[model samples]
Target: MKKLILPFLCIFLLVSCKNETKQGDSNSNELGTAVKDTVIVEVPKVPIEKTIKEIKEALTAKGFKTFEYVDETTKDTILMQQYFMAFLKRSAIKMQNEEESERLQKLHMEHLSKMHELGYADISGPFGDDGDISGVTIYNVPTLKMADSLAKSDPMVQAGRLEIEIHPWWAAKGIGLR
Candidate 1:
């Protein structure tokens, strides 16, 4: 029994290591050069900075709600712009297979990319914790109806995996997330 166990262990280790060695040899160059993995990140294009008057003019031209006030400390005129926030909540039907789920997720990302490219959604992402609310998309559009239409176009939302609840959100113009 001892002799049999020794041979079995030896064969197991030899077979396991042989496959790894073969895999390594197949990836090596003639000169045995090392390979490095590369990662690429896509940066969104930011629009040119506009003056306060220009921003107010643009917002008013688009029929958006805005209010201004002077800060006591800085004394700078603060321009508040109303944006729409779409809360992506988990829906009742969560019955998609893995393949269908993957396809829907891909389509959802494409929809988000198009929104960003069209300057409709300022930012979108999922929540860290698993909760009723899954994600949110901040729409830079002026009207709630337009924002609702955009959110409804998402594949996940259409497929009954998620639901959208839109609300008006306000923030200072030209302000960015820290």
Candidate 2:
């Protein structure tokens, strides 16, 4: 008889414990809204192509022309924290002669092309509208000193026919060959 009573009490205890857990799970808030164990949140994802298109749209709206090139390895987008920007502007000093100016122009083009080929210059172009600023060049160099050296190496800049203003620029990386 004692053995039977002990087993029954154990069973009763187990049943009572399960019922308490169920009751606790069903408890509601003050407003009578049942609580949920887990909440599902929906998040929207943007494709890389869509993001790039939107960026191009914003740039075009502000009179910026963008160029793109493909990378052979790693298809992931290259986002960079900072870069160097060189602003090419006409200096106050005049060239010695038209021939000298032409010679300097050729040398300048060669220098720019070499930089572009060596993976230093990512983008460079003249301003479409006439302004004090002649053109702009973006470099992937790591330091200001390197960028300054590059600018100073230009024949036009060295000859004082053109002046360069270097500034730290923020840009997205891996857009082009650089």
- Assess each prediction's global lDDT (C-alpha) against the native: 0.90, 0.77
RMSD score of candidate 2 (Å): 16.3
TM-score of 1: 0.71
Worst 10 residues of 2 by lDDT: 62-71
Q: Which clashing pairs does model 1 show?
A: none
- How well is each residue in 1-178 modelled by candidate 1, as lDDT tens digits? 9999999999999999877666676455555554556458977699667878888988899988888888899999999999999999999897999999999999999999999999999999999998999999999988999999999999999999999999999999877889
* Model 1 misplaced stretches (Cα beyond 4 Å): 1-49
lDDT of 2 by residue, 51-84 (tens): 5656556655644445444445967544333578
Which candidate number maximizes lDDT? 1
